[model samples]
Target: MLVTGCAGFIGFHTARRLLTEGYQVIGYDNLNDYYDQTLKQDRLHLLTTNPSFHFVKGSLENIELLQHLFTTYKPKIVLHLAAQAGVRYSIENPHAYVQSNITGFMHLIECCQLFNVQHLLYASSSSVYGGNDKIPFCTTDRVDQPISVYAATKRSNELFAYTYSHLHHLRATGLRFFTVYGPWGRPDMALYTFANSILKDEPISLYNNGKMERDFTYIDDVVESIYRLMKKGHLQTRNTLHEIHNIGSNSPVQIEYIVQLIERELNKKAHKRYTPIQPGDVKRTYANLQTLIQAIQYQPTTSIEEGVRHFITWYKQYHNILD
Candidate 1:
């Protein structure tokens, strides 16, 4: 099995889970300074402790490296999770998204097709819904309108995967992940940023006057969904070679409520700064997990409070905070 972005948050956890399941995982990542290179290296260090795990430091844009990976390892299953991931960042650095999510994704799928990869699971985002007024986002919903560059790139990946599946008969699955958060989460994400700000007594910005809501899926649930899909995704019979599913908690919580939870966890009050919503950000995201539940016989069960507690605990330990 080959896992890209093994140094990343979701990629790291997924790679760890796969390694624990007795799979020899060839971990690939560029270890970019997107947020913090130290965090990425720490995650890689943990994965390297596993004898079954092999590390490769390279970017998805390097087709030569990716081709070498596919040619040498001959991974039967390809999990493509490496992408420039930031909605707000995309507004400033659209070129980065185009290069990594578009060009790099093209290289990945091409290698998968050439290598005869049995199953290819890649990440998509709920942002593809694009300010949709619908209650819960579904896979069947029309996602042609993506508001942000990040969302557009994810949608493009789905289309590219579909084209490859049609042309090369490559078994492909696109996972539309919601706001996944937990221990080892990205610092750019709300949970981690909020925690950091609160701990430092800095005012945390609350966009849209804290009116936003999100379906915050836990990391463990996301990993479980991906693993189930990888193991049984081949059995899913469809007219086309491509399939897409929404992996989310199916429960949307308000931004203010999450902040309150974090404050409660740390026993610290936060200085809140109410502001307008940033560009390329959605107001709310709710995922309809009926498709995922039917396919995997499971849905995300971690509640907001529980997930927040887990993240805070990990955060304190990681930062060496004395309680």
Candidate 2:
């Protein structure tokens, strides 16, 4: 199996789980300094100790390196999770999104087609539900109205996957993940950033005057869904190869409420500055998990409080913050 972005938050967990299941994983990551490099390196170090794991450091833009990897590993399954991840980051560096998410994905699909990879599971984002007023965003929703470049790129991935699947008979599955949070979560994510700010006695920025909302799906639930989807992909009929499913908590939480939860867990109060909604930021995101539930019998077990507590616990331990 080949796992791109294996050092990333979700990718790391997915690779670790597969390795634990006795599968040989070829982990690929560029270790970009999007956030803290130490965190990425730490995740990679944990995977490197495993005998079943081999790590490769390179960007998706490197087609030659990608081809070399595909030819060398000849992996039967490819999990494509690497991308220019953040929505706001995409605005500042739109070309990064194009180079990594679009061009890089093209290179990857080419390798998959040439190598005849059995299954290609790629990451999509709930932000693809941009400008969607409907609660509980569903797979059937028309995602033609993306407000951010990152979301646009993700939506393009689904379309490109379907086209490739139809033309080449490639078995491709796209999972549209919603605001994932957990212990080893990304620093840029809402949970981590809010916690960091609150802990440091810094004012946390509240957009939309604290009226925003997000479907905060926990990491375990997201990972479990991926695992089941991979297993289910084998028996699935070819007709369903070009399918997209929403992976989220189903229940949406208000942004202000999430801040309170983080404060409670951290035993601190946050100084917040409420402001209008930022450009490229959506007002709300709620996932309609019927498709996921029907496919994998997925039931999110973690609540916002539980997830926040676990993250703060890990955050304190990671930063060596002692009271």
Candidate 3:
């Protein structure tokens, strides 16, 4: 199995789970300075301890390198998770999104097709349901409108994956992930930023006057869902091979409530500054996980409180904070 972005938060957890299941996992990551390179390195260090894991430090944009790796590994399964992730960052650096999400993803799909990969699983975002006032975003819902470049790129990835699956008979699965958070999460994410700011008695910015809500899925649950789906792979019914599912908690929690939870966990008050919604920001995100549940029996059991507590525990340990 080949796992892209293996040093990332979701990729790391997924790779670790695959290793435990006795799969020979080959990890590919650029280790970019998007957030903190040390965090990526930490994940790589942990994975390298397992004999079944092999690490390759490179970017997906390197088409030659990607093709070489694919040819060398000849992996049966491909998990493509690497991309320029932040919605707001996409506004500042739109070209990065194009280069990585669009161009790099095209190369990856080509490699998957060339290698005759049995199944290809790639990450999409709930942000694809942008400007849709729907409560629980479903796969059947229209996702033609996207607010951010990041969302647009993810939606494009799904389209490309579908095309490849239909034309080349390659089994492809695209996972629309909601706001996933937990230990070893990206520092730029709201939960991690809020936790760090609250710990340091710094002010945390609240966008959209703190009215935004997100389906914050825990890392463990997200990884469990992926692991189960990996085993299931691409279902073969008749001819066409394609599947897409939303992996989320199916419960949207208010942003303010999440801040309050962080405060409670850290035993510190947050200094919040309410502001208007930023560009490329969505009002809310709620995932309709019925398809995932029906297909892979994926039911996220972690509540916001439990997930936050677990994250705080790890944060404290990682930062060497004495309670």
Candidate 4:
């Protein structure tokens, strides 16, 4: 099994789970400074302790390196998760998104085809359902419009994967993840940022007057879904092996409510600054997880409060914060 972005939050958790399941896991990560390198290194350190796990540090854009890794490992299953993430950051550096998400992703798919991978699963985002006021975004919904370059690249990935599946007989699955959060989450994400701000008694930025809603799926749930999907692989349809599933909690929570939950978990009140919605930001994201449920019997069991508490516990321990 090969997992890209293995040093990242979702990638780390998935790799650890695979290792525990007794699979020989090869992790690839660039260890970029998009977030804290220390955190990425910490996750990598934990994985290296497991004998079943091996890691390679390199960017996905490095086509030669990616092909070399694929040729050497000959992994049957490839989980492509590495990308230049963050919708807001895409506005500041659009070229990075194209390089990592577009060019890098193409390299991954090409290698998957060359290696004859049994299954290729890549991460997509709910952000692809841009400007759609629909309550719960479904897989069947048309996603032709993307508000951010980051989302556009993800959508492009799906298209490219489809082409590969149709032409090369590659089994491919694109998972449209909602707002996933838990321990060791990304710093730029709202949950982490809110927790850090509340802990420091600093003002937290509330976009769109805190009217945004997100389907905050727990990390464990997301990893479990991925594991199950990986095991099941992809089914052929119309002579093409391609599938798209939305992995989310199927329940959306308001941004303000999440802030309140964090405050309650920390026994404190947050200093908040309500502001207009930023560019490349969406107002709401609700996922229709019926496909995942019907296909794999998957259901997210963690509530927002419980998930937030778990994250808070980890945050305190990881940061050595004493109340």
Q: Which digits, one per residue and each the tens of the lDDT, describe model 2 over residues 141-187?
A: 89999999999999999999999999999999999998999978899
Tens digits of per-residue lDDT for model 4, 1-323 = 99999999999999999999999999999999998999999999999999999899999989999889988889999999999999989989999999999999999999999888999999999999998877799999999999999999999999999999889989998999999999999998999999889888899999999898899999999999998888777454555478899989989999999999999988999999999999988898999988888778878889999999999999999999887
Model 3, poorest ten-residue lDDT window? 231-240
Give the alpha carbon lDDT tens digit for every residue of 100-158 in model 1: 99999999999999889999999999999998887888899989889999999999999
Candidate 2 regions off by >4 Å? none
* TM-score against native, each model: 0.99, 0.98, 0.98, 0.98
Residue pairs of candidate 3 with colliding backbone atoms: none
Give the distance in Å from residue 178's predicted Cα in candidate 4 to where it truly belongs: 0.2
Top lDDT prediction, candidate number: 1
**Candidate 3: residue 241 lDDT (0-100):** 78
- Where does candidate 4 stray beyond 4 Å? 234-240
RMSD of each: 0.8, 0.8, 0.9, 1.1
Pairs of residues clashing in candidate 1: none
Each candidate: what lDDT? Answer: 0.93, 0.92, 0.92, 0.92
Show pairs that collide, candidate 2.
none
Off by over 4 Å in 3: none
Q: Cα lDDT of model 3 overall?
A: 0.92
At residue 102, give the lDDT of candidate 4.
97
